[model samples]
Every structure is written in structure tokens, then in C-alpha cells.
Target: MGILDAKALRDDIVARLLTDEVDLETSAYLDRILELAEMEEAEHQFLNDPFDRSVALVLQLFQDKDLDPWAVDLSAFLEMFSTRIEDTEDIDLPTCGRLIRMAWQVLRGQAETLIERQNHEDEVDEPWIYDGGWESDFDDNDYNFSVGIITGTHKERLPDMFSGRIQREEGRPVTLGELLMGLKAASRISEEQNLRLKIAEKRRASLEMARERFSGSLHVEDLEGDIRRTWEAMRMRANPEDQTCTLSAISEELADRSMESGTIREEANAEAQVAAMVATLFLVNRGYASIEQKDAIDGSVILTDLHPDESDFEELSLRLHPPPEIEEAV
Candidate 1:
């Protein structure tokens, strides 16, 4: 398809993404459109168009939610911090942990600033401040020299960070690549820190929820039969070789069966959907089945007895958005 047609389709899909809260299938459709553009040798024309820039940013945001393009290293950060102190023995667990947390937040802020700069280059009308913490007494030359060293362009002539006002030049803003150096440093420091916080937060929530009482009417006794039925249904319908089935397929299949059996009068009520998900949870916890959700970005889930150990596994949280119920005919 031509770029115009592609852009129209992309816009429609993006609208759905915004309204529907990031449907992975719709995002995948956008991916396919991009691939088509690449195949037709019009990728540059498609991306460089001023009107399509917003679409590109939206697509990129969904594609890379974490957005840590620069690799962060915690050990190097700690070592560098310790070098500033004369007594390395004073470095303790609490101190190191605190520093790690602080560094993580700082990097996150820097990355956010870089992203804002990229998304709104025209709107940023002022000279961006560098938070490098170099002594304020240092001349513009010193700051520029430090930036060059950090960005690995010390040998090459670099632009003055304060060309506009410091040097009394007419108008010269800092380069995007220069701001990107901050991003890269932030990325490096965030690699270890990001995972540490996420794991800790999620684990805390998972444990807390496990201890808390379920306020819902779905009792354990109520789901005993349903859980078995759900498991058996999965075992039967799952691909014989892979023992896998999409979550949507299994849920819909069970819903249809329940409707036929008169267990549910209407088509897939919210109660019935919740029960299905709860039953699936029971099956997974009991080792009768395992879930395969490679990433939340894809938003595709599969029920499988064949557990893939290499894939990153995230604990299931109760985030279900059932489709709108079908209206009854008069």
C-alpha cells in the first residue's frame, strides 16, 4: 500500500489503541504496515513526513515501553561512588542500596527529559540545563570538555553546551545526540536498578494479596468443579503436540458450553467470565497448567502444560477486561 493509505490505516489503529488501552493485536497490525512500507522501499518517505511523526512516536512508545536503549551497570556506579570516598570500608549494604535507588530515580528523570526533548524539539525554546553536578565555578569550556569525555568524543571537536548565552553567540541549541548521552548514562545506571525495584514491588504486592481476604463472592468450593472442568477442557482441546491453546479461545469455548448447558442463561456474563479466569488461576497454581504471556506488550496469552523455562514469567495480576456482553433479542 502507498504511504498515504498506510498512514490512514495507522491513524485508525492508533485511535483504537488510545481508546482501547493498547490492544496488542491492533499494535501488531501497525507493525505489519511498517514492514510493508519497508519492503516497498518507502520507509524513509513514510517516517520523515512531518504529519506522520506523531504516529511514529506513538508506535515507538508502544513497541518499547521500557525505553532503556542505553545499558545501565550498577556495579560500576557503586565503584565510582566508592572511589570518591577515602574509606571504602564505610561502604555498607544500606548505603549502597540507597545510592542505587537514588541513581535509578535520577536516570529515570534524565531519560524522561530526553524523551520529551525528542517529542517536542520545536517547543523547547530554551537552553536545556545539564544536571552533571560539575562545580558551578567551572567555565563553559570545562563543562563542554566534560561532556565530550563522557560521550566518548573527547578527541573530536564538540559543540559548546552553552553556545547561545555563555559564548555570547546568536543562537545554537545543544544537539539531540548530546542530550542522548545523558540518556545512555541513565540507561546504564538503570539496567540493574529498574529490575530490582520492579521485582521488589511486584513481589510485595503478590505476597500482600495472598495474605488478604478475597471480598468477592467467588468461593473456593464454588469453583472446584469449574476448575476441573476448565482444566479438562483445556487438556482435550489443546494442541496434542504442544498442549497449548490461546486464552481467548479457551474462555470463549467454555462460555459457549456453559450457555448450551444452561449454566449461564445469557452469553458470557461478567460473573461467568470471572469464574473462568479464577478457575484458570487455580489450574495454573496447582501445576495442572501454565500460562504463556511472553510480554504484556503483545497482550497475547496461551494456556499450556508445556512450560517454557527460558521465557520471562510474570506473576498474574487481576487485570481482566471482558468484552461487552451481547444484548438479548426481544
Candidate 2:
């Protein structure tokens, strides 16, 4: 269809929905358009991008009633959002993040509203019973689901459980935040005042450091550039016979740089080392450096300032195992 024909159809549909009661033909017209859009290319395109089309469909279906938490079928709405798009060609991280954030806000608002309503209802003379409408088909293991239902605190997990249906047989792994929420719900643990104070203290220190870094007197170093510079320096410092440095050596160099330069305290050596390793991995990904496990030494990977050759283009896993202290603590 041409642009004029498309506009006429849209206008007619909107008019029918607004004025008179629409019939099945209206729905059939839309369905037919969607079918034709898939099967044939048109001169005028409404939504050529799959991502745009999917998002438009979501808004068309849910923008009105679904925005009202009370009017929405929470399970179905969340299920639709949680499902992976069959066509992911044009979807980017920012788009995904925004969409996920919107869904999260809606879910959070719904939870708060329901909780407040339940609290108000509890104050009434009549007692209210809850139907397990939010609960999914998963069989409760021991006291997990029962206690959560009784306490009403874990209503947030309803979405997680519902979305977890496909992975039901594999066991839905509880995240750290979910586990913490569960512990708090069961009265096993509570946030201490000292913990909050400590967090505030850390934030204050970070803010001060941020101010110092951004001030005109001091310069904020580019971490990736600094890493590359340090790698080049490492090559220069190495023997002419062996110009390469091990990944562990590079990590130690970064840790020392942070400590000696007073950018970070000596107490954070382990964290600095881990951060350095991660940064170097990013560098490797961007082709700034090449990494390979040394056959001569067990569990040792070497890094070089040389750009990766065509032979190094293939994908491979390079494991960065935890330090002995970290392993022991775990």
C-alpha cells in the first residue's frame, strides 16, 4: 500500500475505536496488514525495523489499561516483556536497558500499591483472603514459597518465578539480592545501623576523592591509555631476549602503580590487581595487546604490546583464576 492508503486505514481504525463499536473486521484488517508486511515489501514502510515494530506492538496492546497496575494481568504482561524477541537484529543495549527499566518501574509500582492496599485492608474489621493468582506452577520446596506468601514481603519474586517457568526443571537459582530479601523476610537477618553508617562513610570518602580528581589542579587519568602506556614501558624494561610480560606481572605492575602513586591505598592491593586483570582483558578484546597461555609455565598467560596477527583472531577462553587468598576465603 502507498502512504495515503496506509494513513486512511489508520484514520478509519482510530475513528471506529473512538466513536462506534469496532467489529472483528477491524482486527482482521490489522492482522492482514501485519501478514502482508511480513510476506511482501511495500513502497511505504510503517515500521521497517523489527525492534521498532515490537515496541510499537507492546505500546498498542498495553499503553492504556496496562499502565494501571490494578487493571493489568501481571503475569501475562511480565511474561510478554520477559520473553526474548525472535528477531533481535536492530535491538541495542541502550534500547534494552530503557525497556527493562520501564518494566521494572511498573512492577515496582504494582508491588508497592498492592502492599499498601493489603496493609489498609488488614486494618478493616473484615479479614481478606489472598488467592494464589500471582503464584506460578512451580512446586514449593519445603518452606520457601509458603513463608514468602504468608509474609507478603517477597511479592517481588512473583515476576522472577513467573519468568522462570522455562527453566523450572533446571532449578531457578536465587541471586544474592533475592537471597538477602528472603533472609530479611524470614527474620534471620536485619540491616544494622553500623552498616548504614559505614556505607555513608564510604560514600563521603568517594565524594571527596571525586572532587579531588575532577579539580583543575589534578588530572583524571584515562585507564585504558595508562594500561597501554604501562605495557609499552614494561616491554622497554624487559630483557631484549624476552620482550613479553606475563599477565600476572602486568596486573602486579598496575597494583604497584596505584599504591605507589597514592591513587589507592595499599590495603586495596587485591582489588587493584583484579581490576588491572579485567582492564587488560578489555585491551585484549580491542586488539591493543595479544594474550596466550605459556606452555612452559602451568596456569600462566603472557601479554605482549604487539597487535594480534590473523592467526590470533580465533575465539578462545583464557581463565583468570582467583588468587590463593580469595580461593581460601571462598
Candidate 3:
């Protein structure tokens, strides 16, 4: 989407190169991707040669690497990526040019997906306690926080779901980041609740229908009519503008669209989490652009100075009882 910077991508691949420890297969694929990237960026029509068909398979591999490749089917993708190339030999210069362009598009999409997923996964869902001790409570448990946005721990949804939870418990001033974090959490929780309610209603209706079948009084036409009426009701409720999808699923969709941006969500001890949230708010309202959690256990925050021109007098004023006034040097 962005200017298709193939040279930059090629350089990036070269820098990483990847190790076989992860997956020899994926590593080899990377090698092929990098090779094709270099040739394509160099504007070489070398794919027209007798062995150029293999290059076509490599190019197809890029195209088949889309988000929902299963829709295209593995056999179909295999044929397109590898076998389909066997049919073409001594391809024309124009075709070679098209293949080069297509290869760039495919590889770029795959790279964008990698970057997008990594960015989402890295979101700062900070530890609820030091050294991940919170894991002990919910290690094998799954949470259904408002539904679709289920996290392994409430920590994922809490800061985002309820700001008051953070404020009341943490008892500290909240930060803009913390507020945004809570809004995002709340939005996710709301979406999940909607999904859950819809799913529950559907299941309940199915159960009622199953019970009705046991009564054995309904004719086929009657059953059809009932189904049709339900269908009509669903159609009436379906709004094209309604976007009540799971937040992570929405995130995955955005990734497929080749764009990316997100934020970290934090949830500590309700008190600890809320305290950190409030502490963050304190710094944010004071013209601090950001607050970094240095020690959540101790409710410490670094109010990032967005305006370096200003002094730390505000920061100093927040300080009190410093080393007991150094005993006034006695």
C-alpha cells in the first residue's frame, strides 16, 4: 500500500536472514523470498529463462500468503504456487514484468501481516503483580470477561473495561493513557457482551425448538413457517452499520487491511492496577504526555516531559519529606 519499498524490504531480510532453529522450511522460504525481492528490485527480466517457472512458483507463494489463505484452499494454493508454473516456459518479457510486480505485492503483504500481528501481540498488558505471580490464580482458568474479548486473565480486560475499578482500587490520579486504555477495554467488553447475548439467545431458541420437536405436533410446513419467521426477524435486526465484532478479531481484520496501530492495556491488582491508572492520570493532567510504570508495586510513575522547555519544579513539588530534610546538616 505504501510506495512498495522493495529495496528496503530486501535489505531488511538480509539483515535478519533468519535461523534454521525455528523452522528450516520457513527459513528456506525466506531465502527464496529474499532472492526474488533482490531480482525484482533490480528490474531484471531473468524469470523468462528456462528455469524461470520455478521463480513463478516462488512468486505465487507470496500471493497465497494472504490472511485467509484457507479460503483459496491448500490444494489450489499449491497448484498456483508450484504446479501452475510448470505449464509456462520461456515466458515473455511483459509477463515477466507482471510476475515481478505481483511478487512484490505478495511478499509485501506477508511482511505487513508479520509486522501487524507482532505489534498487536506486543501490546503492554502489563503484569498484574511482580514476576508474573498473578499467573498462579488463573493458570488453568479461562475468563469470559463480558465475552468475546476473553483473556487468560482479567488483567487484559479490567483496565479497559472499568476505569472506576482502577481509580477506586488504585486511589491515584489517572493518566490519559490509562483512560484511553480503560475506554478501549470498556469498548471491547461491550462488544463481547453483545456477541455473548446474541449467541445465548440463539442457543436458547435452538433449545426451545428441540423441545418443541419432542412434542411431535408440528407439521413440516409449520416448522418451515416458524423457521421463516425467525429468519425474517433476524433479517430485520441485521444492520449493515452495526459493527459488534470481537476486538481481537477486528484487530486481525485491520492487520489484513495492511495497516497497523494499537496501545498497551494494563491491569494490576485492582488496587494496584487502579492506583497505577490514577498515578498515570495525575501525570497526564499535569501536561505530561505519557507515564511509564517504573514500579507498580510502589505506585511510582515517570511523568514524561513533553515540553522540555519547562522546569522540573512541578515534579520537585510533588516530592515531600525528602530524606527527612537531610537532618538540616545538624
- The pairs that clash in candidate 2 are none
Runs with alpha carbons beyond 4 Å of true place in candidate 2 = 1-223, 236-239, 263-265, 295-298, 307-330
lDDT ranking from best candidate downward: 1, 2, 3
Check candidate 1 and list the clashing pairs: 71-188, 72-188, 72-189, 73-188
Top candidate (lDDT): 1
| Model 3 segments more than 4 A misplaced | 1-48, 66-92, 130-330
> In candidate 1, which residue ranges exceed 4 Å CA deviation?
1-221, 263-269, 306-330
**Candidate 3 versus the native: TM-score?**
0.20
Instruction: Please write out the lDDT profile of model 2 over residues 1-330, one tens digit for every residue.
Output: 322243333323222222123442454234534544343343223444343344333323333332443323333333333333212222232334444444445445545555554554344332223344323345556367668867897888666764342323445755545645765764432334445455556655654553442242222436656555445534544445555676545545666766776655432344344344555667667656676764432335666765322222223112232235544555
Give the winner by lDDT: 1 or 3. 1
lDDT tens per residue, model 1, 1-330: 333354443443333323234443454345644554454343223443332332333333333345331222222333334342223322222233333334445345435644554454333334333565422357889788788878888745445542333322344555546557767987766665666556556655643442341122122346667875676567656786787876555656667777786754333433344455567777778666787654542345578964423122222121122357899999
Clashes of 3: 12
- Which candidate's TM-score is highest? 1
Clashes of 2: 0
Give the Cα lDDT of each candidate: 0.47, 0.44, 0.37
lDDT of 1: 0.47
